[model samples]
Target chain A: MVKLTADNIEMRFGERLLYRFQHLSLAQNQTIHLQGDNGSGKTTLMKMFAGLIAPSSGEINIQGADSLPWWRRNPLLGKAVYLHQHPYLFEGSVAANLSYVHSLCEGDKATIMARTEQAAKLAQLDHLMQQNAANLSGGERQRLAIARAWIMQPKLLMLDEPTSNMDKLSQELVLTLIKDLQKQGTGMLISSHQACVLTQLCNQMWKIEQQGLTSTQHTPTMAKYSNTGQSQEFSYVTAS
Target chain B: MNDGWLALIQQALSLLFSLDPEVWSIVSVSFSVSFAALAITLIPSLILGFILAFGRFPGRWLVTNLIQTLQSIPTVVIGLLVYLMLTRMGPLGDLKWLFTQKGMILGQMLICAPVLVAMSQAAFTSVDRRAWETSRTLGASWARAVWTVCRELKVPLLMAIVAAFSRILTEVGCSMMVGGNIADVTRNIPTAIALETSKGDFAQAIALGLVLLILSLVLNFTLGTLRGKAEPRSH
Candidate 1:
């Protein structure tokens, strides 16, 4: 099923055309890799898709309800989550951040706590759950971001450069987590410069060139890692 | 100069610690009237401040400019306006609010509201837009996003409150004009100081001035502490 669609979207800043798309659709359980240079509107497009901002001219329909408020429209179909290039953590502990999303979920307190615990375990942050999120290292914050969204079980997850400035270990954990999310039939739209890490997981690749989205292709084999249950080490050299 | 100043300070302290009835009554009236005004003005000013900080609408710039202008207007001007509106021949004359504590409260609220709005708007606007966006994208409603912003910027918001309170509490012009400086009715600290000075009661005037000075010092101390503790971007 086509879970989301954007028809003839246009983004303009004053007289300059930033980018435009004729038609775009994300089916259930699909993963689309977005490749673009810095300041190429990749984040802008993601924000529009998430209904955080409105395009200059376009219709974004989610599960046939086009006119519902962005926040309200998500629940009508399923949740849509957008992750910032650098995710923001509330001023509190990791558990507090997780509990924020948990409270937003439709569940009682006990269920919320249980899901929060499960997510912390999945993100390998259980031990640090009581620690302040701001005090966490960069890789830990990235993992926390994934964990924060994971507990919500969004139908469509839009991640903007989730693994840009990380060591190999953090990259593998994020990729592994992305793969896990894919297995659960979540539609993922990811924008990243590290195409080597995403090639194996993304079935379709789209690139922004000359103010338009053009489909591209890449082939890279996945470097398997040992099943040590922690951040797996990888020996793959990422392309410049 | 040294002896005269020291003597005045000594006299002021003696009067203050002695809990002089007339002086204490004046202080009590000042606090009650200004606190009532502060409480009434806080909610609406905060709401307006948040709106001004985040809202995009027609004439938004104009409204902000108007609030900024009001923030700097002399307190005596505000007093005159309130006096006109509350006089027997004025539009609000039926309420007979002039020369009453309630009348004084109305005038102080007018004085404080604009200060609160202007300062708090700046406080809220200083916050990163990303915080609000993240909260909303994560499923918070508009009001909830604002509440989150308030939580994130608690230090600045409290500073705005304390600043507004200080502005209204020490202002003499508005209380004097609207309260008529009536003894045991609406006579407050500032007005009492003015009367005592006019009557050549320098000791009493110095005592009241000392109290106002102490209050200012205490408020500023709190502001300094809050600045040390404030981590507006901690989120």
Candidate 2:
């Protein structure tokens, strides 16, 4: 089942063009890795795909929803979620952050509570439920954010640099949780610099090159050793 | 240092603490008028501030600049403009609100609306844009997203409210011109202070001054407390 489709997507700020895409589509349970340099418009594309931003000229249809301006009143809501590189942890306990996602639904209190608990455990945040999310360490906050997003059970989840600030252990845990979500049929688009690790879970790889999206399939490994003896894999996809 | 000054201050304190009826009456009127003005402008100012902060439209900069400019305009100029409007020969004459508490409220509201708008806009602008996007991505309505942003900015919003309140509460020019300083009706604290001082009734003037000083201190204290509460949660 197709979860989302974008046709002729283009984004520009005034006279400066950011990116343009001919077409893109996501199927149920598909995981796509998006790789790009710092200023290559990767985050902007994800935001537009999630309906958080309007494209300069294009149509992005999510779950057959009409197009941009997908308001909360739109039924397409609760079906998609986007996590920023540095997600905002609201001014409250970590539990409150998880509960916020459940609050948006129309379920009974007990059912929502169960889901929140389940999400917390999945993200390995069950012990930090009472802690203030704002004061949490970077990895814990990212885990909390993922748990919060999972509780909503969005069909399509877009994550920007979900593991950038995480330690190797934390990154492994996050990828494990994401793999679990994929098994349950959650389509995902992830933007990250850790290509070797992320590509392992990706079925499709997309990169921004020459102001447009370039598609590739997952390679056996993007782990290439550089002359400096550092493990740098993916080529830096800079803007033209 | 002077015995006469100390004596006058003592008399003023005695009258203030003794619940002098005439002095209390002016204080009551002051509170009522300023509170009314704030109540009238609060909702509209918040709405305009949010629009200015987040809404993308042509001429947004012009509107923001206009509100900022209005905030710095002299209170007496606003008083004079409102006076012309409320005078018998002016456009709003038929309301017959001149020299009434309502007229003072109207003048104060005029002075406060832009002040509230400018400050609240700055507060809203300071909120992380990610908050809005995250809320919407989580299925919050636009209004709910805006409300969440406001929740995140409770401290700054309170400061804006306190600022607008203080500006109208202590301003004498608008109150004097439009309220006409009528005793038992429009004789608010600032107008009363001005009148009493000119009339050489130092006791009354000093008492009103003391009241203003306490009010300002209380407001700053509350602002400081809010800042303390907000620091840990703010990013």
Candidate 3:
């Protein structure tokens, strides 16, 4: 199983400290909800795990992956995929973006082509394949970004505020895609300040507050809807 | 006087259409020398530009400023420097490149490199950071990722190349000093134009001038089409 572990990690920018965590490990079949307020380094932490940046002081190790060649500098890259808050879609049509990522994936030609088509359909972007990705709506852009990663079927995925600014229908669409990936045992670390449809899927929580990080077992309170959808009951519980 | 001007224009067109050997030879020399210099300097200058834009090292700011300063120095000054370096008593005297095409190419390289580097650096710096991150995270090799970013900035990078080529191709001082403007040997369009004008051969000068004008129009229009196609990115 793919795994990532960080030990005694501390992040700092100039003289200001961001956060410090003693030990953390994420492995396949584990889904985590990373919670923090604005500027609490949520994005920074996700980028760190994605190997896009280095922490001030710490070692991060990835296990159960093929050995990278000497020329491949960062071992953590391609190990986990990180989606930005406002996803960056390449300059092209939706089909072109999907084809771009499809070229990077390791699979037979036919299988990858099939996966690309399936990803587009799952993200509800099949009809918009010929449209310019730059002209896509905010939700469509995020969906396209996630669809690109979904083609790879990455072992781990980090979503940074994936649902923010998304309409309810778009959020539900993204939730469906994430739910499929979870069923396929893709480890996920989703960062959001408030509980959303995606946060309900996490079995564990990591919260950053006052320059410290805490981990806990979480059982998210699911909203129960009536047939008329007029009244709802809310419940909250957590296990330390 | 108007009739004299009309006759000169007619003669210029005739020389060009007839493919007059001397005029075409000078045109050939200009293109060959400029092309050689651009070919030799293109990859190295772009690599340096990329490093300046992305790599962090000591003296980076100083180097960037130095290149910016170099871009504005007069071509005549560069010609003089190359002349001194290639002169008999100079350090490079043993190579004996003085007053030769090699010497002209060397001078043009110095004239073009700074333009390529500075403009390319600006283009690279203007690229979104997420382009690189997205490529790397999507499992592209380092070289592939750089290529992708270059693809994304193709218009600007190509404009840099065209700007550098135009600068070197139109420069007269360096070719005159370092190449000696010898007929059928090292003479180029700009130097030939300067020579023909001075010798009252207005037809040949105007012919060469037309060639430069046409080339400039073509390059600019091509770049304009490309820039028009590259829609402004949203994020």
Candidate 4:
């Protein structure tokens, strides 16, 4: 199973320390909900795990990654797919964006193409295949970004505020995609300030508060509320 | 006077259309030299620009400022420096490139590289950081990620190239100083125009002038169309 482990990681910006944690590990079949206040460096932490940025003072090791060439320094990159809160869509059609990761995928051409078509359909973007990704609305852009990641079928995925700009219908669509990924045993680290439909899927919770990180095994009560159609109240209690 | 002007214009057009050997040779020499300079300088200058924009290292600020200063230095000054280097007593004198097209190309490369580097650096600096992050997170290699970013800023990078080409093509100072305006050898459009106009031979000068003007119009209009089509990206 693919796994990421960080030890004695301390993040700081110039002179101001953001947060410090002693030990953390994310592995396959683990679904984590990251919680923090605004400006708590949730995004920065996720980016660090994705190899987009270096930690101020720590080493992060990746297990079960392919042996990279000597010139390729960080193995964490491409091992974990990180989705930004406001996803960036390339200057091309929706179809182009969906197929961009095809070359990076390990499958054969036909399999990759089939996965691309499936992602487009699952994201409900098949109708807009020829449309320019730049012209897509915020919700549509998020969907397209997730769909692009879905085509990769990554071992680990980090979603930073995945449903922030999404509506109810769009959220449902994304939820279904994430559920499918979970069923396929993809590890996920999803960051959200408050509990939402997506967070309910998490079996563990990580909260960053007052320059410290704490982890706990979380049994989501919202699933029952969701079933009983009282999720609005559950969301309010968890948010506070 | 109007009749004289009309006759000169007619003669210029005729020389161009008929492809008079002398006029065409000058045009050919100018293009060949300038194109050589641009080709030799393009990739290295762009790589330097990208490093300046993204890499953090000691002396980066000093290098950036030096390049900005180089962009503003007069082309004639650059020509003088190149001339000294290629002179008989200078360090590079053994190669004996002075008064030749090689000398002209060397002079023009010095004039062209700064503009390309500075402009491309600006273009790369203005690129969205998310572009790089997204590409890397999507499993693109570092080289591929950089290529993707460059593709996104293709219009601006192209503008830099066009600007550098125009500068080198139209520069008479470097060509005249280093090349000594040798006929059919180092005499480019600008240098030829200067020599012909000095001798009151207006027809050939006007013909070469017309070529430069047409080239300028074509390059600018093409860049304008590209700029117009590149919609402003939103976050």
- Native contacts retained, all candidates in order: 0.37, 0.72, 0.63, 0.74
Interface RMSD of predicted model 1: 3.3
Task: Give candidate 1's error at residue B231 in angstroms.
Answer: 4.6
Better of 3 and 4 by DockQ: 4
Residues B199-218, model 2: lDDT tens digits: 99999999989998999999
Backbone N/Cα/C clashes per model:
0, 0, 0, 0
Off by over 4 Å in 2: A64-78, A216-240, B232-235
Off by over 4 Å in 3: A223-236
lDDT of 4 by residue, A1-240 (tens): 999999999999999999999999999899998999999999999999999999999989999888999878889989989999999888878998888898999989999999999999999999999998888888889999999999999999999999885777788889889998999899999999876768888888899999999988777665542533223423213322
Candidate 1 runs further than 4 Å off: A64-78, A196-199, A215-240, B1-21, B200-214, B231-235
Q: Which DockQ value does candidate 2 get?
A: 0.49
For residue A199, model 2's alpha carbon misses the true position, in angstroms, by 3.4
> RMSD to native for every prediction?
4.6, 4.2, 2.2, 2.4
Candidate 3 DockQ category? Answer: medium
Local lDDT at B123 for model 3 = 93
State which candidate, 3 or 4, has the greater TM-score.
4
Interface Cα root-mean-square deviation for all models:
3.3, 2.2, 1.1, 0.9
The DockQ score of candidate 4 comes to 0.79
lDDT of 2 at B129: 90
lDDT of 3 by residue, A1-79 (tens): 9999999999999999999999999888999989899999999999999999999999898898779999997988988
Q: What TM-score does chain B of candidate 3 reach?
A: 0.98
- How well does model 4 score by local distance difference test? 0.91
Candidate closest to the true structure, highest lDDT: 4
Across residues B115-228, which tens digit of lDDT does each residue of candidate 3 receive?
999999999999999998988888888888888889989999999999999999999888999999998999999999999999999999999999999999999999999999
